[model samples]
Target: MPKHPIAVELEAINRDGETQVVRDCGLPVQGYSVYLRAVEASGLALATWIADYDTIGPAYQLAERLSIALAIPLTVLVPEPLMPVQSGPAATTGVITMAN
Candidate 1:
């Protein structure tokens, strides 16, 4: 199956002492292009970088290595599935409905 796009966010400080959060979204191999652009433009000093994805995979590993090498804090954000809701009739009738 094809992998989902991952989002990388960086909290950085610029030359003016202003702080901002920059983000890039793409496949793992593409790297963090948007954040790099911000770095080149503003000379940002990274405070922390966050990797948000659905699963623990290549993107997570890459972020961890980059954090270690750059000596920046890394935060991983993974989503949890929502629990199914039980309603009056549906709960007792033993019937299920799925949407397409």
Candidate 2:
């Protein structure tokens, strides 16, 4: 796998403990603030969410209600679905078997 340029820069800065430089360079793509801002902009009004499954319609209604009540732009925040972690020896291989 090819090393990404941004990764290389980050690694170098990390090695040197360049805290200031790291802050200046900004957060990595998957940063929490980025996700929060994106969700809020989309009209979801959560700073974060509880770790539980949710039904969408009620959440959207609440978001809309709150937005109107507070006269602020925001939306309901919901937890992302869990992504299964790949591990063990089988992880190295990409094939997935579907039981019939």
Question: Model 2: per-residue lDDT, tens digit, 21-54?
Answer: 2232223212111111123334443333211113
Residue 6 C-alpha lDDT in model 1: 27
Native-referenced Cα lDDT, model 2: 0.27
Q: For model 1, which pairs clash?
A: none
Best by TM-score: 1
Name every residue pair that clashes in candidate 2: 43-74, 43-75, 44-74, 44-75, 44-76, 45-75, 45-76
Ten-residue region with minimum lDDT total, candidate 1: 29-38
Listed per model in order, the count of residue pairs whose N, CA or C atoms clash below 3 Å is: 0, 7
What's the TM-score of every candidate structure?
Answer: 0.29, 0.25
* C-alpha RMSD of each candidate structure in angstroms: 17.7, 18.5
lDDT per model vs. reference = 0.32, 0.27
